[model samples]
Target: MDSANSKITVLYEAPQPEEYLQLRAQTGLSLKSLDGAKIGLANSIFAVILRQEDKLIGMGRIIGDGGCFYQVVDIAVDPAQQGQGLGKLIMNEITTYLDIHAPKGAYISLLADVPADQLYKQFGFDYTQPKSLGMYRLIAL
Candidate 1:
């Protein structure tokens, strides 16, 4: 039941809180909103959606500057709707965008939560080198 054949329409730069909520709920990610802000905090990003009919069933995004670095984040698909390759649909779009637009020699990275690493590998993503380390700083508001 791969969604690759389904009529899933993709979009870019979709800033909607409701859709972000649904994706967060499905992916079990920690997302909190202050005021009415959407999940967009990146100066440059590639966002894509998977819609069946008019409902958004899946989404993924890459965020970073245009020329120096990129991080693939927030790739989510409804849990009840897993195993349909909808995530693949979302990743394909994001990867295409990075391949076409990210500056040459820019370092692209992402933290794969678990088994999703396999999906990402299809899109030319990989783990960082042993000499390199990943770091993060939580936003405290």
Candidate 2:
């Protein structure tokens, strides 16, 4: 099936925790422990994409302290449905939410993986260099 022409719908809703795990694995994103996923998702604002038959194809989420910081995370698309502008659709919904709900001077951020940074640049995200850098440390279970 040609995903480009297939009817795709982007919904401003969170995927089920199980669906979130499946989509993350399919898209090669880091796997989240089920217990962790449950807690994290409960605090996130999400956008989910569905293909023709209601197949979950993509999703993105904003997780943060709600008032001061917001990080865009879990942007993923089914491998078969990629290159069909689904990522853009996901970002459009995310940014729309930010524009409406983010407080003035709020810090919105995302960690784009390699070439995916190009996609995010279109949404006005720029590198924070010469002043601050993005970093993280994974907790061992």
Which predicted model would earn the best TM-score?
2
- lDDT of candidate 1? 0.74
Candidate 1 vs. true structure, TM-score = 0.83
**How big is the RMSD of model 2?**
2.2
lDDT tens digits, residues 1-141, model 2? 345457666676777788889999998888788888888888785555555567788888998888899999998988987887878888888998999999999999999898899999999999998699889999865
Number of the top-ranking candidate, with lDDT as the measure: 2
**Which pairs clash in model 2?**
none
TM-score of each: 0.83, 0.90
